[model samples]
Target: MRENTRIDWHARVEQALARVFASLDEPLAWQTLAGELHASPWHFHRCFRQLTGETVKQCLRRLRLERAAFQAAHGEARITDIALEAGFETLEAFLKAFRRAHGISPGGVRKLGAWAGTIAAPSNLHYAPGEPRKHFFIADKGDAHMDVKITTLSPLKLVCYRNFGEYWNLPGTWQKLFELMASQGVAMPAPTGMTVFHDHFDEVPMPDKRSDAAVYVPQDIELVEGLFRYETPGGLYAVKPHFGSCEEIGTTWDKWREEWLPTSGWQLDKTRPSLEWYQGHFDFAPPELHVTLLCDAVCRA
Candidate 1:
């Protein structure tokens, strides 16, 4: 059954790639690509990346520049016309991107009669003969049994306490936020709590990591001194229910990033923050706890 699932995923991804290449002259939409594979946009994105080693956006941009480079090297047509045909909005934008990728201007390429060879040639899933399959599977670490879905979330107004520092210190911040909320008389029946991570640890220093411990509350709730209101931007997310000790949740995230993400055809949506959705009570000690991790998946400009 696992093998069959893997095969189906690969076939669907290949089909989606074909569709994307067919319409290279136009703007590519995640929704359209997801629909083609009958998969969620986040899932499709991860899978595409896993199969191709490039995000959909990256693949499209590379293909366009390669086409433009070819024209610049071998054709006499005006650069503006070629840029427009390659889906660039303007000649200037095309030249900037081309120079960045190839280390040479279109005019330089034409005059020199050769491309700088810095930019790799465009490639598709169907490689030349003797090429090996790029996708591979990792040993399932029970996370494969976890259910994941791409969902659109409505904007949520949160009563929050912000924290800045190392991630391990977040628990203390949560305690402070909870105390502040209680003191402010901002209480909710069956309250849903979340911890929002605002910075990627890999991209930022430990001292710069920012997190917020928040709870959904009435929109009109007045803020107390240390507490403030935050509106989580509504967009698509990939959510997974986690059942484990809060401390072990980081392991699950690692599994997703190292094991699942590469093959999932999705990339982390860095524009928006990721959050930990608290479903119910969690005993920090032993056994395991049930919570949900909401990861940003929508790509925005």
Candidate 2:
């Protein structure tokens, strides 16, 4: 069962969150925390972000603000004291940031009562005087929604442009890649567009997530600036053909992991990358419907 792995992840994150809550005023001890969790810094960062849907920095800041709000609304502490405790060095800086975060000055939180300390967070985590959450973030929402096919793949020679940032902004990158292709006079034997995710979707924040927009090209294809030619080693993959808006593709992949992988008699090959093949018109408009084959590398379970 996947229970052991999931339990271990939850336990590790619970420990880290507790440590973070203990020192809201200080920067999180990333290396030490990673050590305690028995994970590399990169892996821990990704795991935390994936579990909370917010980076550690973002989580710490929001949690501290929640505490400040609680103090303002219910406690008799002075506003300056609350602000300082919340990690702001000065009252003015605190007020500006506080207003920006909660849509009002610290003073306004006093009128909110029960709602005062709550803020919109992806994980629904808040600052409360209680034990940490066992289930930090929503997982396993994916069902048998995508039609997944298990198959073997051949090697691929690709010329790709890597981009980093919000995946939602990938259409813009696709457009830029096309322009680069035209400017370099790249010919059209490029039948399909490929995207290779160097990091897991949850491994890094959207800004740091590395995605390569690639097209199949010759092994000896001449490379230009911002474009590199490389061979993608292929193997067993679980693929799903997603039709419609590119924005909805994430759900497909999520279900592929949550619903399919556990039951499929295969496991993800972490050494390889998550890959995708788009076999349709390159409208460069993410909102426009398109067909995509989402491929995840796998090995025998």
Q: Of the candidates shown, which would achieve the greatest lDDT relative to the real structure?
A: 2
Off by over 4 Å in 1: 1-146, 188-190, 283-289
Candidate number with greatest TM-score: 1
Candidate 1 local lDDT, 73-165, one digit each (tens): 777989999889878888889888877765567887687553322233212232112344333222232435446777888888887888887
- Prediction-by-prediction clash tally: 10, 0
Give the C-alpha lDDT of model 2. Answer: 0.72
Residue 99's lDDT within candidate 1 is: 73
lDDT value, residue 132 of candidate 2: 45
Clashing pairs in 2: none
